[model samples]
Structure formats: structure tokens, C-alpha cells
Target: MFTLTTLVLGLLTATGISSAQSGADGTGGIMAGLITPHAYVQKRVSSYDRTGANADAIHIAAGATATILDESGPGIITHIWFTIASPEDLHLKKLVLRMYWDDESSPSVEAPIGDFFGLGLGQYFLYESAPLSVAPDKALNAFFQMPFRKKARITVTNQGQEDVDSFYYNIDYRAYSQPLPSDTLYFHAEYRQATPAKGWTTDWKSNGDPLVNDKKNLNGDGNYVWMEATGRGHFVGVTMSVLQNQDGWWGEGDDMFFVDGEKTPSINGTGTEDYFLGAWDFGSHPFSYASFGAPVKGEELAGSRSSVYRFHLDSPIPFTRSFKATIEHGHANARSDNMFSVAYWYQTEPHAAFPPLPSVEERIPRIYPVGGPGNAGKNP
Candidate 1:
């Protein structure tokens, strides 16, 4: 299995850039590539006004789309930056971001703009990670290296009822004269949600009761799927935002990964918090890191909200035929909270078609009344 370290070190070869031109010492960070560069032309396509006017933002009407980038390339996108001003409620969740690689009709990347930037609740609080971040004052940034052979296109659609007053963006990419290496893979992200996961029963006394904990879920039958892909690639990470419908701790669930379409998961984790590199309900506090974080830690009560993320940059799980990344809603699939997530990966195209995104109303985060600690013994 190739790790992100291997991928980063192999970037020169993957992008058809010779080692002599890169001058990398294998000791410095990604900055080592900056020491020597002989080949590609670095370019940027931003929302700057073509007329060279002072106003450099685009206005997108409700139900309309804005083309952010359209370029012919044997190139790789290095960075993407965006800042927006809007009036619609939950505007971030209503804005859909899509990317097409090699002129494919279907997008390889389709996710809510906020979710794609690790703010799945449509509300942003500053958080930073290796490949994605929400910086100071609502600046959304991404550093994923997206390589395309023939063409690359990116668009954002306003699904809200109100028009987007201002949309600002800048996409930086490298234009290569030479073709990318054959092993280079395209990046992809897909969004999915379960307004409220269904459990066998919600009348349990506690999370550890035999009625809940003893029910085996070895196959991940009712697991909330983060990503399911049919291709050759590895899952990079996930951003998950949760709205609590039921009360009490909402993370006794375990993380499970079924690689290459196996009947059972080969990778199983201890618990939800543990999978994100945290423990004990994230110590009931917020934390952010380069590879994993719980940026929004919620109270153990109904209507609470939490957002967490994790990137498998250290050891990406590789799959040959398929990959299914899932996690139990609660131990033995026993919680009914609202779950929304974006799964990130790199794979060979033409990748599997993504399911249609939920309607704007459906995507909005809200708590649903379900029976748990809040009303454990009541009918639900």
C-alpha cells in the first residue's frame, strides 16, 4: 500500500518532471520542490473581472451556476481559494461544487461547497488540515493536487432561493508540456447523508446494555457509508458533520472498511472518536490537526451539532477492485442521529457515478426527534 509520503515523493515522476529539475533532497517538506523547477508553467484562473474593472467578484443568481475553471491541460491543480458573501440561510450547504476531469460528462468531484471545504454544517469555524481548511474570516482553501490529462472544468451552482451577492475564487494549477505519468490518479469527492439512521430499537437503557451492545454488526449492515468506489485507488479521508436527534453520547459506533468487496471488513476500529484520532468523546473539547480533528465538539444533548474530520495521509487504504468505507451509527447500529459526510479519494477514471445530491431542503442540517437518552422509554 502506497502512503501519501510515497505519493508526495513520487510527485516529480508522476507529473513527468525529472528529478534533476525538482532538486528534492527527500528530507525537506513539500517545499523542497521549490528549490529547483525547470519545466511546467504555473498559472491561475480566478474570478477577476475580464474587463479589468475594480469589481472582481461574480454574482450568481438563485438556481444558476458559475463556471469557476475551464482549462485544457496535461496539468495539475495546486491550490484553490474562495471567499463568498451571501444572504441565504445555510448558503454553504446550498452551493454545489462539481468538477469534471478529462471532459467527462459526469463529475468526478461532487459535494456541497462547505462540506468539500470541511465545513459540513454550512457554518464555518476556523479549522486547518493537511489538504483542506477554512482559514481566517471565511477563507476556504484546498491543496489537493488534481491532475487531468485532456481537460478540467469546475463549477458551482447556487441552489438556494437567494442570489449569491458575491463569489470570489482563485484556482492555481500547473500547465505541463509533457503528459502526466500513467500511474497518476484523478481526485474525487462525494457527499452522502442519512437524515436519521434507523436502529433496531431505541428503548435501550444505556449504550452498553445487552439490547444494544450485544447485537453483533460484523458486516457493517447498517453502517453509515462514507464512500463506496469501484476502481483502483485509495481512500484519502472524510469530513463528517452530525446533528443530534437523540440524546446522550452519540459515538460508540466503530469504523469499518471493506476493501476490494470483501464479505467482511478487514479494517475495524475501536470507536468513532478513536477513528478520528481522538478518544473519550474527544475529551469533550475541540481540536484541530493536520491529519485528524474534531473542530466542533457538541454537548451530549439533542439538537447539538458536531463536525469532525480525518485524513489517511499516513497510510491510505488501497483497493484493487472496490472500496467501501463505513461506520456504525452507534454500537451495533443503534443510534439515529443525522449524519452528513464527504468522502475523498484518488482513483482511475471513469469512476463510478455518484448518487444525485439531496435537495437543498434535505441537505440542510436539522435535528429529527428520535428516541434515545432524551426519551429512552417513550414510544418513538
Candidate 2:
């Protein structure tokens, strides 16, 4: 069950094809040739007025769910755009996004709308990436290609107590006359959070002190997980938001990937910033790029929020059996900080059931009285 991402990556590895030349095959970028006719019919499901009026937005009452799209397919979703207006705070986290493929009873994708769009801390900030983006003035967009054979359904549930004043969207897709390739994999995104990651011990002088750095974490024990999946597919990327509960740097931890149930991580990185394609604590300023970035840089102090993202578009990590992506909170998992993240990938159907989403009160970011400069050795 190779995902389309894996197929492309395999081709690249086998043929010695450069990433920039990927579009030379007439399937990729602007070089894909808009002048050339396409095989599928372009379609869109949007929040538009049925009677052709100007009021194109819809209001979703509290605890209500809005089915944004339901269509029979041999179709592939290409793009999604949304702009929301709500009075409630943290509306992004309160709105849950779910999508199903091929009439599956379980959702293939489940996450907070904000996290899915790379706004993991329930706050809006402009950033762009190959698959997801948050544009000026609170516009969220996604360009992930999601293919389905029999059906595709997308919905948003309002889990808050206040109604969403205005919800607008445009979902662009391609309706194919023939069936999709059998090897095409479905898209998925799952959210996970640790309001405050528990550390082994708070008895430390500083981040680099021997008390904190001497411990070993060769197996990623007690690491905060980005995602875990039991399937055959490839991992695409992750967006993570961190709320500092301590007074030092929160990214001394390394990233480890245990693929196919290996006793130890087969793929490991030097540090969190290194895995995110940054060095020296992301320097003094924030930066954003097409594939990897830290858009919201936070101070090295308590009660600060930072969001970072990285997409393995050029090289999606493939797995045959299982994949568990995790990262330490600090060196050897010794930092107590709040973390929220969403992992994206393409996989075969019947994915492992996701863990239950945290309660609304738990999802909101806040300073937990934990191991830190202000509340050292205090319980959360």
C-alpha cells in the first residue's frame, strides 16, 4: 500500500531526478503546463448563497456540526480555503475538523481547525508552506491532494458554547471520469497535546548542567509524541506549538523516529531546532519558508508561545508497518513545558483510532505551575 508520496519519492530516488525537475513530467508545478488540457473536471464546493444573494456565509450554532462537502468520487480534493469570524476566544481550537474517505465509518482525519492550518496554539499568525497556510487577515488555506474512490465527506463541528458568527469556505477538487490509481493513498492529519509535559526530575541547576544533561534517552522514553500510526504509508510533516512553562530554552530535546517497531529509533536528529531546519535556537528573529519555519518565535521565559512547522515534501519518510514520531521536551526529556502538535501523512485505510481529543479547557494554552523559574517543583 504505497502512498502517492512514497511513489513519487521512489521515482526520484530510482531515477536520480532533481526536485526542481520534478515538474518536467507534466504533473507538478507551473511547468505542469496549464495550457495542456487535463483529464479531470475541476469542481468546487463552497459556502455560497443558494438563491444567489450576497449573504454567502453560514452561522454554526454551538455544539452544531456543519457538513461542508459530501460528494461521490473518483475525485481528488486539490485546495481548501476558509475565513472565519467568531466572537468567542480560541474559536480555532473549539472548531473540530474531520474528513472521511470512501465512506469509511471512522474519520481519516481529525484535528482542531487551527492546528490543521498550522495555528496550533489557537492563535492566528500569517505563515505559508507547501501544503498549509494562514494568510493576511485570518484566511486559512490548504493544498493537500486527497484522493478517494467511492466517496468523500468533510465536516466541522463547533464544540464551543458560542455560535460561529460567520464561516466561509471554498473546497476545490477534481472529479475524474475514471477511477483513481489503486496505489493512491488517503490523506490524514491528527492532533495531540500535552498541556504540560511531565519531566523525570526538576533537580537541576541549568539546562546544560550535568544534572539535566547527564541522563540518557537513547530510546526516546517519555518523549512527547507527534504521531503514531500502524499502517503502510509515508509521513509528510508536522506543525508544533509550544507554551513555555519554564525559564530556559525548550528545544534541547532531539527528534526520534521508531519506524516499523524498531527497539530504538532508526532515524534520529541532533536537536529540535535541527529537525526543524534551524540552528542556534532559531537565532534572534523569526523566519518562514516554503517547507520549514518557525513563524512565531517566543522568548526564553515562562508564558511564551512559539509555533514551528516542517514539511517533508521533497522527502516524505516511508514506512511499511508502523511509524512513531516523537521528540524530547528537553535534553533527555528533562523539561516541563506545554506542547501541542498536529502530524500529517498519507496512509492505507483502517488507520489506528486516534486518542480522544483533550477537553476545551485542557486544549487552551496557559502557564502550568510546573518545573520552571517561577514554579519549580510545583504540580500542574
Candidate 3:
């Protein structure tokens, strides 16, 4: 069976009546004919031989930025691969990714490079999911399909204190001869973080029953919002990292999704682990699935950290007017952990404005122990 993402993309890209809607009225696919054979074009944007030598990679000075890929479209970014030689984890959080679609001055996508590629906590571990993966020795891969009608620009900004002396990447995209359909959606990824999440300190466990003393939050007010936007699109899911602040499970919080500006969420999950498609505190095992996985499920302890992701490839949450995707910091919004997340979605161009990227000081993935004070979460 085709995943909903596959089905939607296939239907969206169909060449006429073949479920690939290549042009106007679906008749264009047939009229274009199979004899001429549609042409496919490809290009790679990489750190390669910039100075007439075989040496690749770029040395991005601290606080400087590089335009890695800039192309006129009627094209789709098919695959992206990246790896940094630096050993520090902070670089992952410091190096940001930004993409502009079809002449939009502001970015439609903005996030930390690592977080955007699934290492949300600024650390890398070998893991895989349908849309993203990590290989041995810190290789990062992303398979999100990004379609553009007029133009696409991708850049990497290094906000770190140390210069990135070695940065390698390959961005692969395919160019199309015809214009993309009007309904085709643009890709988006946004990042958010709240170290030592401002949660209740009273340890109000709900005993796993949502109805137990849970009457206060009808609007998901205190939930850790992964992404919120006003637009027409579908929620692709998120990359999440939870640095435990208490000695108990950090996933008792629920996943709540409010669509179309509803006061109450229409899609509510059972628990944080449930939203990530895990059970029993993720079994303390690193695992991957077709649509979801906890690639980095650290030890179940205070200060322990884990990275998890869920891709709604099967059924992306569709929203016509707006979307607010959030999850609790702890059961009943009671534990103050370090929460970092990147939300992925697809919508038409001119997307809702994104909040400013958090400062490097704020983006650092530090661990905060329960009841600790003053940036306990800022250091591991």
C-alpha cells in the first residue's frame, strides 16, 4: 500500500490520467505522448573543488553563512546529504538551515542543520526513518520532496562561536520541463526550543488518564508547541528531543493538535510516547520504523536525553486555515524538561511568518535536572 505521502505526491505529480497529474486537465499527460519521452534534469550543489583542487568542503567562518544551493525551479529537491568534520555537538544547533521558495525574501524553512536533518538535540546517532536518517560517522540524510515553481534558495548559516572549517554536502534536485501545478505545496520546516520548559513544578501526574484532573487546558495553552501556522497544508510531523529533568518518564504528556483555529484540539494523542509510536518508555532501545521511531532513546533517568521522530506519511494532519501542533512538557503540564523540536509540513508559498530563530545561547541542548535552578539545562 502506498503511504499517504506517496499517494499524495504521486497524485500530485501524475502525468495526466496516470495518477501523476503532469499538466492541465490531466489530459496533458496523454497529449504529451510517450514517444517523445519526458526529460529529466539533475544537478548537485556540493562543496567541491572550489579552488581548482580536488579538496571539497567549505570553511564557514563563525557567524558567517554560505549559499549551498540556488536554482530556478519547476524543480524538486530530491535528496540532501550533509556531514561536518567538527566533533562538537553544539555545531548542530548552531548551524542553521534556511530555504526560500519562489522569490520569497524570507525563508519558508528555517532550522538548525542537525535538527532539520533529525538530530534535534545537536547530537548524532545512527538511526533511520522514512524521511530522514543518520549513518555511521555522523552522515546525515534527508529525503523530503521539496517542489518549487519559480525558484529555490538554500543556505547554511553558522551561528557558532568556532568557525566550521570543514562542511560537506550534496543537494540533489530534478528539474522539470513544465510548470508545477497551482495546487502543489511548498516544503517547510521550523524549529523551536524551551530549555527547562516552563512547566509546573508540583509533579501533577495524571496516572495516564487524561480525564483525571485535566479540566484546565482546553486550548493547549501550556503545551510545548512543535509548530503553529496559519495556512493551507498538512502536518508532516516532527523531530523531537527530550532531556529529562525528573527521574521518571518524561513522556506522560499528551500530543494535542488544533486544526483550523479550533479552540480545542481535534486530534489528541494518548501520550508523548504514544505520539512517537513507542511503548513502555520506548523500551530504552534505539529503533526505526517506516513512519516513526525513537532513534535515540537514552536511559530513563533524570538528565538522560533521547531523540525521537514521527512522520505522518500514512495520514498527514490536514488543515485548511491553521494548525497548532503541541505536546505536554509532562503529564498535566507538570515537569520542566528541556524540549527541542523541529516541525515539518507542506503548504502553498508565502507561508505564515516564522518566529525568529532562537539565539545560539538558547538553542544549546543542555540538560536540566529536576528542581535545579539557573540554566541547569544549558549544560550537559
| lDDT (C-alpha) at residue 50 in model 1 | 92
lDDT of 2 at 66: 98
State the lDDT of candidate 2 residue by residue for 115-144, as single tens digits.
Answer: 999999899999877677888999998877
- Candidate 1 structure quality by residue, lDDT tens digits, 102-132: 9899999999999999898889899877778
TM-scores of the candidates are 0.92, 0.93, 0.85
In model 1, the runs with Cα more than 4 Å from the true position are: 1-9, 12-27, 375-380
After superposition, the stretches of candidate 3 with alpha carbons farther than 4 Å from their true spots are: 1-38, 50-52, 87-89, 203-216, 369-380
Model-by-model lDDT, in order?
0.85, 0.85, 0.77
Please identify which of the two predictions, 2 or 3, would achieve the higher TM-score against the true structure. Answer: 2
Residue 112 accuracy (lDDT) in model 3: 89
* Candidates ranked by lDDT: 2, 1, 3
lDDT of 3 at 310: 86
